[model samples]
Target: MATHMTSKKIQNRMKRRVALNKGMSGIFLLATSFGVFILGVLFYQILTEGIPYINLEFLTGKLSTNPDRAGIMGAILGTLWLMAVVIPVTIILGVGTAIYNELYAKQGKLQSIIQTNISNLSGVPSIVYGILGMTIFANMLNLGSVVLAGGLTMSLLVLPIVIVSSQEALRAVPGYLSEASIGLGATKWQTIKNIILPAALPGILTGSILALSRAIGETAPLVVLGIPALLLPFPGGLFDRFTVLPMQIYYWTLDASLVGEYQFLASATIIVLLIMLFILNGTAIVIRNKFQRRY
Candidate 1:
């Protein structure tokens, strides 16, 4: 009788555990579905409101005070010019810092402190980076609100993320690969170039692209830097005054109440920005996949 009671208690406990598991699973499924549904709604709204406005003239037009006459071509050109400065500076500085920290720096208190600060920086608000950029790049360096200043500011904003992701990618490369390279009489640089880097390239590219995506969409920093939303001339070079899609969208959205058409214009700019993001992300995925297969 005592043995029978123990068996019954055990079965009851197991049944309760199973019940809890099912409940948690149901909750997770509901959460995921809710997120997906929200995203679907957003996409639907954007497509409906924005697609009608996109056309060849709209694509090739310039910004104007009149909502009907305004085109985002200047903004598009500025965004591309900003990226021209951002990509090289971020990759070079961010990746170089990551390589040094991960491969060369001796693990110590200083290294720990540096790593912790970098992680913290990644979480810092975009606006703070904007202030920093304004003080240093804009005022101190005299770069003003040009594309170079904006690009450098953006580079600083996303640098920590790129560094952290690159470090993680580097760490993920197998220990044996580097060891084997060394055993085969390869130097540190040779080993990194020939083995570790190629192995980690896919992950590095994925992280860098993600960071760049954030930079491209951010409005706060550009706003703080006084990047104009209605530049008449297209940005002809890095030093030229410019505006980006996000800035255009932001200003238009704020002016939408005065001019209802500005709202549609904002949506159209959003559509363009989304298309650029999709293309950028798709290209990154393709390149990363190819490298992943190679490595």
Candidate 2:
């Protein structure tokens, strides 16, 4: 009788535990669904405003006083140019910094200090970067307020993000690979270049996407760095005065006179930005899947 009672009590306890777990899981699912629903609503709103306005002419045409003739060609080209310069510079600087921090430096106070500063910098506001760029890259260096100046300033804002991401990727590479390469008579540089880096390439590319997407969307940094109020035609080079879509929208939105026309333009531009982000994120996913299949 006593043994039977004990078993019955244990069974009841287990049932209660399962019920509690199920209730908690339902709550979690409800919360997650609410978040996804909110995101869906935002996407729907942007799409409704943006999709109908997008046309080939709008994409290729120059800025104009007439609404029907207006397009984003110059702004689009400027953004592309900014990305071309910023992306490569950031990859080199950020990856190099990560390699130095992870592989070369011993865990010392100096390393800790460097690490601390980098961490703090990632949290620094983009506007602060604009100020720094204007003071140093623009004034002191005399690069002036141009595409190159803006690109350099934007690069600084994103540098810490890349370093953090690159370091994580590098850290994920197995230590044994480094040891084996060294044992096979490879130098530290050789080991990193050939063995560890190749293994970490997928992760690095994934992180690069994150940084690039952010740079593509950022407006205030460039604006504060003195992106021109207008560039009706596409630029010839980095030094040529230029504007980007975000700055274009920002300029137009604030103009009480042109708000009705520019508001529609801004909506259309935001849609393009979203599409670009989708492509970038999709590319990252494809790369990740391909690498997984191969490796």
Candidate 3:
């Protein structure tokens, strides 16, 4: 009887496992079909409206009244300058804060306050951030809506996001790594800098990519802060006012008069934006995989 009962239990467990595997395959197939459907729709729409307008002139020249003469030179330059400032600052501040919180600080009232505020800041509306930029960076500092002001304002908006992701990445590192470092005669700071940080660098980089992608696609924040969306000459300095791709896309979508032109430009901008996001995400994934193998 005992033998028979044991065999029955084994059979029931096998049946349950087989049923779960069957359900898993069905769920995966549904998810894959949805993803492919969306991707195909997006590809078709972008190709339909964007392919015609994507010429050398549009890619490399200045915005012009000739329509044929217009291009994204200034918008591209502005975006580059924004990223040049925003990325470094965000990484330094956000990752620094995360490292301190996870590897150094103990759970205390102050830590709780900081965590709560950060979580709240992350949920705050993007438009609210725009208003803050306008009031503080632009108005108080009198930066006069230059690229620097716009970038800094956006920097603050994305800082919380970076910090949150960085903290999570750092947290994912096993506590034993730090414990082993401590046992090897390194100070806490040295252990974090040399051992923990290098191990977690890939994850932090992944967060940076996510933050930057958000920055690149943001329009309301730049627009509300008064980025000139139609600059003809490419900006030569960070302090110089500039246009960004999202701002250009927004401006194009504003008027019904330039329907074909606007639709064409919007689709092109979408393609450019998507391509940039894909490259950054791919790089992050590569780094994550590489570092995971290294340590």
Candidate 4:
């Protein structure tokens, strides 16, 4: 009788624990569903208001004082020029820094300090980078609010992210690969170049591309650097004045409160911006998946 009572008590306790866990899981699911529902509603609203306004004329024409005639051609060209500068600079510097730290730097206080600073920088506000860019690139270097200055500023903001991600990717490579390369009479640089980099390329590409995507969407830094939303000419060079899709959307959204029709224009521009982001993110996903499968 005593043994039976003990087993029954244990079974009751286990049942209660399971019930509690199920209740907590149900609550979490409800919360997640609510958030998704809200996002779905917002996307539906944007699609409804923006789709009708998007046309070839809206895409290829220049911004105008008249709402019906406004377009984002200049903004699109400017954004592309900015990316041309940002992509090369960020990849070179970010990957180089990661390689040095992970593959060459000796473990010490200096390395720790560098690592800490890089991590801290990842959390710094975007507007702060803009100020730094304004003072250094704009005022000191006389780059002004041109494409080069904007691109450089955005690169700085995303540099830390790239470095951290690259480092993680580099560290993920198997130690045996490097050992084998060395055993085969390869130099340190040769091992890294021939074996490590190819193995790590997928992670590096995914991280860097994601960072660039974030840079392209940033508005605060550009605003601080004084990018105007009214660039009439298409950006033909890095030195030319430029404005990006986010800036145009921002200016139009503000104007929408007064003109009303500008809201539809803003929505249409947002559609284009979303498409650009989707393409970039999709590319990253594909590359990441391909490398994962191969490796």
Candidate 5:
């Protein structure tokens, strides 16, 4: 009888455990389904409202106060020019900092402080970087609100993300590969360049592209930098004052209440921005798949 009672208690405990597990699983599934449903609704609205406005004229024309005549070509060119500055600056500085921190920096108080600050900076609001840029790059440095200033501001905003991601990718490389290279009489720099970098390339590229995706979408920094919205010539180089897709979307959305057609234009710009992000992320995925190593 005592043995029977113990078995019954054990079964009851197991049943409760199973019930809890199933309950949590159901909750997670429900949450995921809710998020996906919301995203589907948003995409549906954007597609329905924006598709009619995406003609060649819309894509190629210059910005105008007249909504019908307005085009996003200048904005597109400006965005591209901004990226020209951001990509190289972020990759070189971010990757270089990561390499120094992970491979060369002696682990100590200074390194710990630096790492902690970088991690914290990654969480800093984009607007703060904008303010910093406005103060230093725009005002103090007299760079004005040109493409170069905006690009550098965006670079500062995303730099910590790139550095942190690069560090993580560097860490993911297997130690054995480096050990083997060193055993083969490879210098430290030689091993890093030949073995470590190639092995970690997939993760690094994925992270950098993701960071850049954020940079391209951010409106707050550019807005704070006072980037113009309309009637601007195409940005030919970094020194020219410019606008980007986000800025256009922002101004159009604001003007939408006055003119309903501006809403559709804003939606169209959002679509283009989404397409650009998709292209970037798709390239990252392709590169990652081609170079990804199991070990």
Candidate 6:
């Protein structure tokens, strides 16, 4: 009788522990749902306020002191120019570094130290990168606040992310593939170009696109570089002074208190920015799904 009673008590305690776990899980789920709910509310607000103001004139017209005539053409051109520079620089350096570290660098204290530093750099604040860019590219190189300067700054900001992601993709490629290529007497560079890169391209491109998207949305670094809000002429070259979509939205939102139309304009710009980010992410997803290898 005594033994039976002890077993029953132990069973009851186990039941209570499971019930507690379930309760905590439900609480966690609710908290996650709340965050999604808040994000949805914000999207709804932006869409409703901004949708009506999006049109050809608003998209194509140059900035104006009069809110009625203002548009985002210069901002759009500047953004394209920045991307033109950012995409190439980031990909070449990022992918190159990833390949070297993953395949060429011997695993040791020095490699470990380099890996740790890269991981830490990935978490550094965007503003810190901006300050560095201002010092190196802007002041030291005397590039000023031009598209080239902004592009280089943003490149540094996203470089670590691209490198980390590329490494992961390369690491995921099967070792057998590389070994077989070597057995076939293929040189390292040829093997990497033909076998490894094709297999890893999906992940590499996905990470690159995401990194570029982050660069596009960033404002703090650009603000630090002192990109102007009112570039009358569209940036036609890398060296031209420029402003981007984020800067336009930021400046307009600030001006909204004084000019009611500025609020709608800001919302419209926000919508465009959202679309740009969506396209970039969607492209990444599509590429990932399309080229993802079984091995």
* Most lDDT-accurate candidate: 6
| Model 3 agreement with the true structure over 44-101: per-residue lDDT tens digits | 9988988888888888888765555668878888888999889988999999999888
Which ranges of candidate 6 are over 4 A from the true structure? 1-17
The candidate, 2 or 3, that scores higher on lDDT is 3
Cα lDDT tens digits, model 1, 1-295, are 9999999999999999999999999999999999999999988888888888888887889998988788999999999999998899999999999999999999999999999999999999999999999999999999899999999999999999999999999999999899999999999999999999989999899999989999999999999998988646988998899999999999999999999988888899999999999988997899787988432
lDDT by residue for model 6 (3-69), tens: 9999999999999999999999999999999999999999999999999989999999999989888
On TM-score, the stronger of 1 and 4 is 1
Q: What is the lDDT of residue 113 in candidate 6?
A: 99
**Candidate 5, 211-266: lDDT as tens digits:** 99999999999989999896988889879999999999999999999999999999
Model 4 TM? 0.94
Give the whole-model CA lDDT for all candidates, comma-separated: 0.92, 0.84, 0.85, 0.94, 0.95, 0.96
Per-model tally of clashing residue pairs: 0, 0, 0, 0, 0, 0
Task: Show model 3 residue runs off by greater than 4 Å.
Answer: 1-36, 256-259
What is the Cα-based TM-score of model 3?
0.87
lDDT digits (tens) for residues 132-240 of candidate 2: 9889988998988678988888899899999988899888888888999999999999999998888888788788888888888888788777787564468879887
Off by over 4 Å in 4: 1-17, 293-295
How far off is residue 236 in model 4, in Å?
Answer: 0.5
Q: Lowest-lDDT window of 10 residues in candidate 1? A: 286-295
Candidate 2 weakest lDDT stretch, 10 residues = 286-295
TM-score: which candidate is best? 5
lDDT, candidate 3, equals 0.85
Model 2: per-residue Cα lDDT at residue 190: 96
TM-score of 1: 0.95
Q: Which residue pairs does candidate 1 place in steric collision? A: none
Name the runs in model 1 displaced over 4 angstroms.
1-10, 293-295
| Deviation of model 1 at 10, angstroms | 4.4
